[model samples]
Target: MSSDTSKFGEYGGQYVPEALMPAIEELDDAYRRYVLENEDGFVDEFRERLRDFGGRPTPLQRADRLSERYDTDLFLKREDLLHGGAHKLNNALGQVLLAKYMGKERIVAETGAGQHGTATAMAAAHLDVPCEIYMGERDINRQRPNVFRMRLNGAAVNPVTTGRGTLKEAISETMRDWATTVETTHYVIGSVVGPHPFPTMVREFQSVISEEARRQFDDQVGGLPDSVVACAGGGSNTMGAFSRFVSDESVDLYAVEAGGSSLAVDEEEGVAPNSASLSTGTEGVLHGARTKLLQDRDGQIVESHSVSSGLDYAGVGPELAYLVDEGRVTPVTVDDDAALEGFHRLSQTEGIIPALETAHAVAWLEQATSEQLGDSVVVCVSGRGDKDLESVIEETASREIPNAPDMDVFSGGMR
Candidate 1:
């Protein structure tokens, strides 16, 4: 896709009113100039900050036990080691710096899992900019740890009660806030699924993952990875890890989506839910751009449930939809049980507990091995599992176990 027409694949043109176009155009122009001229320095500065401030080049460890269990080569890109514990900091650092360069006073963002909110708060604190994070009431409750982290970082967290009180509702609130205060407040979108300059801009900032992964894999294994996999909520981490390999058609790109319960047999129906939008969704306009959405015939967005809070979104980014359509990317869905299982498996085997969101990618290893994927598969472990301990324990306690024949038999006693 050329730069001029890259705004929308087939579905994502500027559908906003005339007033908003100029603002969007201005952002696009400024971003284009920044990318063309100053990106080299911006990237270098960001890397230094990530190394000294945020921690860069997190180890790409080979998952020996996981590889043996799955019978395939599996390597983990340890993004969970980054400061703030996810890929959110990459974009937050870039955008916050850009906001500083533009002389913006306040920064505002919307977050679902609160990872992005916390990261943004950290950046704003570093830059001494006023920051506000809008989150849905439900999400705030579910992701309280991150909310508190953001508050400790000095960001005021506002709860959105309108609509479904989820990420979508939070997005609506953020958009309204941005429209009213666009001049002094820079809205930092958390993912790659937003407006034009946003999708492109966020992707550029996140491309650092693939850039480093390319060199790291070469140093470790002496060549590019055979496959690169990441969980896709709005696809920031996935896009980041896949950007440098975009032109490398020979390298495989796998995007894992939340597939709840459908993977386990003997489990009751609906025990797990599936939120695979690209596989089961249709083209539609959602959250400012045209993309694949899990919606009904009447155009109302359907309620999407996933074990991963981050991947619970109803719509995906335009570029991903384009890639899926062109067969450049493969989309797979894993159930909640599988993801939870994969989480425990990785934790026990590799001593690396991954976020529930990132576990969806690990779960894909099961399917990938079954399909005979090659020896080297790199999975993006986007965040640590610290946030999911409670849920994991709760789910484990709820499982059913069969009764043993007799305890006396094990004790060598007569019954």
Candidate 2:
């Protein structure tokens, strides 16, 4: 992985224009220097802060009840236990610290689920730097809890209403903000997407999960698991878990995408629910990088829909798209019902309420059982359900077809 000139694979090369190349190159240089010269102490300090402040090394627990029910071995990499209640904080801390080291002030970021927004805000508060987060008006309405958390942490949240008022639009707003304030502001992208160093940089910070999970799983199971599973929105948690094990060909890496309604059918007119970037997306430029996006024949990006706010994007990270194309990663889709069912199952069975984003992985576990994955699968529980409670309750309560059969009637019968 290190031998490759690009970050993860060929998909992660710097793809910005000549004008931004210097800035990208400078960031790459700084990051490379920091990794080579300061990684040891930097990582130690970061880990200390994670434990004492950010709350990390979250447990890797056996989902015994779910495993028993599904007749498959299931373990959760409990990132939900991390401070700020998601895996976002891991990279946020790394980036914010890097900003401080570089003598930059005023952190800026964009968020969809608000996990990243809250994480960035928390990091800025800890480092005593002013922070601003751009969120979609739709997301601000949906993820109210996180918006409140951001304010409490002393960060300003700006709502963007252009376009469809979703993640893609918020990203555009953020980029515009970054272009205007590039000198003194560091734009902390939430996930392993975007252009150049962002995909590489975010992955490096989040790679800690794979590093720790490998050691923990090795100690507990005597070797690596048969497969590593994670929910991929912007592909951070999946990248976090897969980065360390990418060289281990024996371990299968599975990424679950949000199949909103019918996994077998597209929710969009003439596009299948599974037709999002991973499946139907074509190579194109979006969010400052050439990536696989679900676009029309005329190259207009099509709107994407998913019950989970985090996964409702029209494009995926370039690296992930390359991984999908190269067959290094297998992408699976789980419908909204399955995801909600998985969310309820985890909450009732293991007392672990997962974020709607993380629930995608849980839903995949249900399918994995029928395929007989044996007792060796680890799912990245990327975020907690605290941010998703109200929506989950509302979703689970609204019955689909009156008198419809309750698939999980035994799992406490809806929220």
Candidate 3:
């Protein structure tokens, strides 16, 4: 909410077609009116909805067993318990509220694992607005339960088959849809990506995570955690977790990425690496905002791979790109097998089934140490994994096969 900034230190800007400018302007104006200008209690109304309808003030719980195993103090910000089953609902509710203020009759959104799509659909249904969700055909199959949930919430799910048929393509398709229907439609971008106002807007909506966590951590732990961690795709969850802590230099921030198949690759055909974007990608634009993106030497975007459908993207949020350049956030990568192990570990040890996306943060513990992690660490368990049961079963079956590459990476976060 800094009046002095829109571009995140040269990482975020409006790099879209000229035709989209008016819609962006209108959106910015409406957001300022409804959210920033709050004499009418617009923000309080939103807070009421979040607490009573969407379930805010999600608990911060100590992970005694997991902490014992890791030999470090571990805490979980249980965003998994929120209604709609993920941190996606926070942004979805706020954006839908903005759409209502803008007099938009319909909502358009994109999803990778279907969590955001389902969350948006539920928000639209609650507010009695028509909703359309663009998701990849591949993601719909892997995340079928969420697809059904979206349908049940009265939202239309459009499958995008172009490109890698994942998050990036879904965003492309959503952008195309929003372009033509700008009059009646509002694009509820699910993550901290997209053009100027969006990356900042989503962060504000999701900032409730850190705002509540900071006080709760002080109350529970009697001090700030030494480190805060979350999985990063478009980086909403990570941004939320790190929002307040970023200014506290003594607290370390870690953003774990999806190391789909390999942590590093050089022109290997059919091999995709989703992690190492800020670490390896060049400055580029994707989904309207200029940031770090995986691309070839010719500047064409390359394919990104991930076992977790949610973290399967070729780019990250502009704010995260800024944080990377400033060295405020340490970027790390966790591969499929390691993340799967994290999923199992939490389920067995803590009785929590995390979404595959959140598992990537948990997977970082395999290679971590008490010295580096320090006495207290908080990891955002961003979502529950009920939607990923079938996928996890198949991944476990693949691991049972001898000579499977997964076994080697099981001990490490990288492929």
The residue pairs in collision within model 1 are: 50-55, 259-334, 259-335, 260-272, 260-273, 260-335, 260-336, 261-272
Stretches off by above 4 angstroms in model 1 are: 1-4, 17-19, 39-41, 261-273, 370-372, 400-415
| Candidate 1: count of backbone clashes, pairs at least 3 residues apart or interchain | 8
Backbone clash count, each prediction separately:
8, 4, 0
Q: Name the better of 2 and 3 by lDDT.
A: 3
- Runs of candidate 3 with Cα error greater than 4 angstroms are 1-4, 266-271, 400-415
Q: What is candidate 3's lDDT per residue for 132-198, written digit by digit as tens?
A: 9999988888999999999999999999999768888899999999999998899999999999789
Which window of 10 residues has the lowest lDDT sum in candidate 2?
1-10
Please list all clashing residue pairs in model 3, or write none if there are none.
Answer: none
- Candidate structures ordered by lDDT, highest first: 3, 2, 1
The residue-by-residue lDDT of candidate 1 on 1-415, one tens digit each, is: 2244645459556555454566567667666655545754755666677788888878888889987887777788889999999998999988887777667788999998888899999999987899999999988888889988999999999999986577777877888887777777788888887778777788888888898888888998888777899998788998998889988887889989887654221222222145677767789888778888777666777666776778877778788888889888888888777787778777777888889999889877877753535777888999998877766666655652122112244468567
Report the backbone clash tally of model 2: 4
TM-scores, all models, native as reference? 0.90, 0.91, 0.94
Residue 102 of candidate 2: its Cα lDDT?
72
lDDT of 2 by residue, 250-309 (tens): 888898888876544333553435425676577877776677777767677777777788
- By summed lDDT, which 10 consecutive residues of candidate 3 come out lowest? 401-410
